[model samples]
Target: MIWFYERRGEHLRCEIRQQLEGDQFALVVTMPDGSERVELFEDSRILNVRSVELEKLLRSKGWDGPFARDI
Candidate 1:
């Protein structure tokens, strides 16, 4: 998996790793060097997500937009 990083605040960071298996999307995230960890979102909520709007949500979450520019 590729490394995904985001600036949470002025100097905070959120790191993530993602992958897809079968019909589900697997996502894991950690903040402040694994201080607060979250993982295994079943992704059932994404069933009706449209690509265009998904991009917008990512931006709002401080994702830096995309892999190319963010990384």
Candidate 2:
């Protein structure tokens, strides 16, 4: 329920909330319209996802990656 992006044009605020599913991290995307979308990443898809690699992954999906939330 945190603001991930500022409202701009057609893009509303987006958020990346993490959920604990088994031993993996479930990244839940909360869209501007209050809709939720979950992205599942296989081990192969994230086994090497670190720093720059992870940033590229998120950027590929139109995300700005994780950032500090403003109070």
Candidate 3:
């Protein structure tokens, strides 16, 4: 899998990952407490999400930082 990630100081981090096979994707948000919330998506759902929606999803999961694009 490949990840696109952003860090918010030492408190939080979030990453979006795509599998090598390209069948599914996952969003992983890491909180200050070192716990993670991961959600999996089908290819269509992942590909169809807009940047705004992505940020919203992150916020809902407790990440209050700007979104980062995949490098």
Candidate 4:
């Protein structure tokens, strides 16, 4: 799954997918500046929790989404 947030004409991306190397999942965040951060999780539950937390954090910081697609 993927989500996008926007602020001041910049975009932030968040994507979640299963990793090929193990029974793990990845939470990949692409910052507006173009740097990327990858986080691994043992299961979907934890990944989902973290995803929600991230969305809330970004919203509090004045970003605009959880958007299903880039705007």
RMSD of each: 5.8, 5.2, 5.0, 1.6
CA lDDT, candidate 4, residue 23: 92
lDDT of 2: 0.48
Could you give candidate 3's per-residue lDDT for residues 1-71 as a string of tens digits?
Answer: 22233445545556667768767776776766789888777865554474458667766865556735445
Q: Write the per-residue lDDT of candidate 4 for residues 1-71, one digit (tens) a residue.
A: 88899999999999998989889999999999899999999978988899989989999999998789736
Identify the runs in model 3 with alpha carbons over 4 angstroms from their true place: 1-10, 20-22, 44-51, 57-64, 67-71
Each model's lDDT comes to 0.44, 0.48, 0.61, 0.92
Superior by lDDT: candidate 2 or candidate 4: 4
Which wins on lDDT, candidate 2 or candidate 3? 3
Clashing pairs in 3: none
Using all chains and alpha carbons, the TM-scores for the candidates as numbered come to 0.32, 0.44, 0.52, 0.92
TM-score pick, better of 2 and 3: 3
lDDT of 2 by residue, 1-71 (tens): 43353333333343333445654444455666778766554452463343346445556767653455656
lDDT per residue for candidate 1 within 30-57, as digits (tens), equals 3445555444444646522433354466
Model 4 residue 32 distance off true place after TM-score fit, in angstroms:
1.1
Preferred candidate (TM-score higher): 2 or 4: 4
- Stretch of 10 with least lDDT, candidate 4: 62-71
lDDT value for model 3: 0.61
